[model samples]
Target chain A: MPLMFDHVYYTYDASSPLPSKAIEDIHFTLNEPFFCGIIGQTGSGKSTLVQQINALLRPTQGKVIVGEFVVDSSKKKMKEIKSLRKYAGLVFQFAEYQLFEETVLKDVSFGPKNFKENEEVAVEKAKKALKKVGIPEEYFSKSPFELSGGEKRRVAIAGLLAMEPQILILDEPTAGLDPKGAQEILALFYDLYQNGTSILLITHDMNVVLKYCTSVMVLHQGKLLGMYSPLDVFYQKELLSEAEIDAPDLICLVEQMEKKGFSLNRQNIRDIESFVAEIKKMKGEVK
Target chain B: MKALPIGRYTNYDTFLNRLDARFKLLAMILFMVVVFIHFGSRAMDFTFYGLLMVMVLVFMRIAHIRIRQLLRAIKPMWFMMIFLLIINVLVVQTGEAFYIGDFPIHYDALFNTLYTFVRLILMLAFSLILTATTKPMDLTYALEWYLHPLTFIKVPVHIIAMVISLALRFIPTLLEEADRFMKAQASRGVDFENGKLREKVRAIISLIIPLFVSAIQRSTDLADAMEVRGYDPNGKRTRYRIMHFAKRDVLSLFFLLAFFGGMLALSICGIDFYAFIL
Candidate 1:
């Protein structure tokens, strides 16, 4: 069963005379291992909605049902929540700030340690997670703070992966990194999702959303603007405009081509890989 | 990440923001001491309280900010207030030093215990006023300029002032980062508050690790950038905005002195008449 929210709403300070609402009436559900992307402008409450999913934020006036837990209602103890944590791993924007270990190994071991895993076994899991993130074994003993920006990002992810969460949420994971760095991280996530890890990618990078996310959600000024299959969501130009965002360039290009009498679905335009693949498919069909 | 500040003091200026840094600092200190020392002796707390309200009202009017905006700034401190209250009442063990199932009831401990509780609330309020009325940059500069005389003995007042101001300025940013870290951990099912005290403390340590790391990194980068820009920590630098106290500032200083002097005199008289001193 997927995680669902029923009429969720949240504000920064509820008691304030004029509360600054972060999100409202956010309703959505996600089955396991879905590669979903959240797209919105600067203050569109995109982060707020995703935050509620993992119980990072309690809904001000609604229910957040993640698997068996009903947050803001359930009498479940902290131990019960720890098990839930094992299922959902969230990677924050600039997650590098979360790194406070003497060594990369020690840092990644934090999540497993929290679950009361044995020391040796936690190290084993940490090693595997680190390798998966492309960090060499030699870097295991090195302090994580000494690593480069991209390395720090991977290490942060490794820290989360050590928990072995089935559902992973990453917020703007590739922001402030180079294009190559962005692609590498996205590819890692894509592979992970394909291998059965649920992924939530919150980003302003439309290309990342369109290219990798199987589902797309749009938020605007603390409201659930819309959530749709990526293809369907990509064509709503007016909606995107109102949200102070733009559709993927490829999405627009394909739509413009369709408008000029070329019959096309105007989807699969997020990544250059898909860009080439769609053109090839079209040429073959024409022949 | 920039922290959201909520209060009547906006970054932009008015007459209050333009006073001599030293005068403002001295005035604020003297005012706070007088407020704490004499607040209990007043026959009409409401009138004095109303006077404070009017001052805030005047401050808000001049600074072009609304008093209504300070509501959010007052939220998070509630837990602390209640915590201190409970500790005050339960820890003193007076009033027959009795307990109802290991809970102590105290009589004489009431005032001594609750004194700090209310004192902090007012202290924070005034500090908030200080912060709300002044931008982080201006506050730091003011302190540096005000404390410049201390450097004659080789104290490096400018450097000390800079460090403090930098730390103060980044408080909100660090808080925001810490909050995000907690949220991220929470999503993964980490219940920070639901565990044993040791466990909760460990969770907090885990949360602070990244914030401090980022802080060190930012400062290192800042140091490098400053060095590259030909910035000299020890060298005298020209300031773009000249610091000066105008006629309004002189009047404000007089008001501060009069308020403090009257409060001191009132407290002395109160002690002579009642054999008590606040």
Candidate 2:
């Protein structure tokens, strides 16, 4: 099922006398098995936009449809809100804080148990998710707090993955991790995407976008500048500047090299290795 | 993720908003005491109370604050106020009793409860006005000024003032963090809304543990930031925004004193009180 946002507008504390718009006129759609990156400056409403996918926040003026579940102001008490969150699991920044169960296994099982799964079934799903996220079985019965920061993050992701969401939404999932840790986590997300789950990552890291994301949505002052394939987004320098989004270093370096008389024809090259290979080929041609 | 209405400040150059913070704080305290202690059941006392309420309403109007804001401030307290009224109405059984269904409603109990309730509401209204109109920094300075005498005993008054100001500053941050924690837990299927009493308590525990952990982490970061910025509680520091006593502040203080004095004299003479009609 394709996720769609229809002119979604949201105001924080709208009932108060002073209502400030968090997101406005946001429109986008994503089909299954796509890895999408949402990039924006701070306070540009990236977090607010991704949150609507799970009905954690309802739109003030429009609608957000995740699969068959629709989130609008009128759906405040809709029976599908719980299911919507389950289907589109949102892992917040510092999600490790959400773990309160005595054991990591129980913590990961919380989501499935909440969805009415029996104890044995939920435990089985939790175990599979834990293993999938690369957590060792010995740590299953240990306290989440006792684990290192990276381990805690994996456990947190396992908790959401156990829910078996069709679309996984994460806000700055690699915010506080080291480079290796971040790479490992992003690899996990890529694996999940290859397994048929669509992913929406809210991040400001352009490197992650160019590397893992298939398409990117650029937000500026609560408005969508454009949503395009990752390479296409980088080529739109004017639009990227308007959104204050920086293109990946490799893309900028390639553009600079092209300006310096290097005739490179490779398109949509995302990684450093591919761009270097293209540059080496141009050097060989010159020789 | 901003939750909790602890009354944010509004910038308005109105008579109340422009009053000297120290004078306003003192006048509010005295006014509350007079309203509570001298509220006799005479005709004149009721008239004075009515006039006091009218003055407050006029002040709010001049300050550009709507009645809805006042009502919103009182919204959370409605449950407690109603509980108080019902419990008092049912528990006290002296004086003339009337049957509203099987419960005995006593005249004296009802009168006393109503009197206290009005006092409580008025007290809350004045506090709301104070918080809504005055900036928190001004309040912190006013508190520092009022507590300056404690320095005679070598109580580290500056440090105390710094702590109070920092606490006030973190109120909004902690509230926002708590809101985020609640939402994060909710996403994990922790049912915060509907559950049995035991289950609800367990859910609350889930929320509090995360909130407490985040609070500690935030405080550590804040302290480091303060240290980096050369903030020393015992160090001598100069004020950036000096307090000034303007003409409007003097006028406000004069009016509050005169109003309370007039009420006192009228209550002594006993003119038209006895809870006046409505």
Candidate 3:
């Protein structure tokens, strides 16, 4: 069964002097093998919403069902949540810092060990995870902090991938990486998604959202403002503006080109390669 | 071990920050006692007040903390102030009883209570200023030095100091972690707010379990890291961040002595510092 939330209301500290209502009566669902992008301006409650799926948060009102697991306002956290986390690996922002083991291999194996997997199987899982993240097995013996920026980030990611979770949630996985590194990391999401893992991707990058996401959910001021296919979502300039977001440069380029007497169609072509194709076709017609 | 105010320390280069935190600590505790315990006799209280006024001036000069700001800091304690006012005026009726809707107010007891509350407010204000001005680790070091003699009595003073600083250092991190965990739980359909006491506790426990797990995981990681880094907690340690009191610190100590003397005189003379008269 897919994860579902019904009329979830959440607020922080009824007694707090600085009042805040993080999420209010929000409803959403995530189906299997889904590569979903959750984009929001900061404080739009995107982080709060996605965290609820893995039992990291319980809705203040209403109910949530993740597969057979029934999470109501009542269910106290059990080993079930731990099991859920194992099934649904959450790669937190700055997850790299969670690396506490002396060696990268051991650090990667930490979660599986906590899950009570035997040492051998845990190590094997770690190795597989490292490989999946494109890290050489030899680097496993080294300290995680010793790795360069991109490599350290991948190692941190490898730690989550090591658990072999079915539903993988990554928050801004490619942020703060070099351009090539960002491309490679985003491509890694494609690899993970193709392998039948459900992915909930939280990012601010319009380019990342436009490219890999199967469905896009836009969050604004702690509300689920809109959900749509990539092209439909990008064209709504006002919705993007209200959410304080921008469409990718490629989308902007195509739209700008359309106004300049060019009959460039954006459908069946949402990438730079397609843009390139349309440009080359135009060049030929000009000749 | 929690840093008294984890994220609230003000940053400025002033005399208060320069003085030996040990001195401020020892002197403040003594000053606090003078304010609270010496309330009955108005004559000696006058001397302590004179001393506190002098120390306040020296502290303001050195710490770069303003007296006006410190007084304003007491604004948040209005609830406590009201509680004190009521307790002073009622319950402990030492003199004439005034009735308000069948509740009798003891005028003399009320007078003493307000006096006591003012004393506490001033005491709390002084300590708050000290904490708000000094670094937690610095304060820990001050406590450690003050309690160094306890080492001879087998107290493991260093361990206590380490625990305090580490606790202080971790508060901000733990708060952030708790915030993240709460968000994560919320997304999962765990409601932390809007419930009866039992239900609220249940929700909080859901949040706390993860926080506890994370804390333990962090501690485990820290243990391993410390072992790898060759840290022997039981072993005598070298100081990377050394503590040295400057000449200004010595001058501040002298100022502290003057305050200490004045508080002694106030307690002997029987005066209420808050009222500026007996």
lDDT of 1 by residue, A118-235 (tens): 8999999999999888899999999987889889988988889888887888888888887887788788889889998888889988877777788988888878787888877867
Per-residue lDDT of A140-219 in model 3, one digit per residue for the tens?
89987688878878887887787788888888888888888888888888888998988889998888888888998988
Relative to the true structure, candidate 3 has a C-alpha RMSD (angstroms) of 12.3
Query: Compared with the real two-chain complex, what DockQ does model 2 have?
Result: 0.63
Q: Score residue A273 of candidate 1 by CA lDDT.
A: 74
DockQ of each model vs. true complex: 0.43, 0.63, 0.08
Residue-wise lDDT of candidate 1 within B139-191, one digit each (tens)?
A: 78878887788888899887787688778777777777777777766654456
i-RMSD values for every candidate model:
2.1, 1.2, 7.3
- List per-prediction Cα lDDT, in the order shown: 0.74, 0.83, 0.74
Model 2: pairs clashing at backbone N, Cα or C within 3 Å = B42-B273, B42-B274, B43-B272, B43-B273, B43-B274, B44-B272, B44-B273
- The ten-residue window of minimal lDDT in model 2 chain B covers B38-47
Per-candidate TM-scores read 0.77, 0.92, 0.58
Q: lDDT by residue for model 3 over B222-258, one digit each (tens)?
A: 8799889998777998887778877877886787688
Choose 2 or 3, whichever is better by lDDT: 2
Model 2 C-alpha lDDT per residue in residues A1-287, reported as the tens digit of each score: 88999999999879776789999999988888799999999999999998888877888989988898888877457676778888888999888877778899999998898888999999999999999888999999999879988899889989999999999999999998889978888998999899899999999889889889989998999999878888778878789889887888888887887899777764747788777777778788889
The DockQ of predicted model 3 stands at 0.08
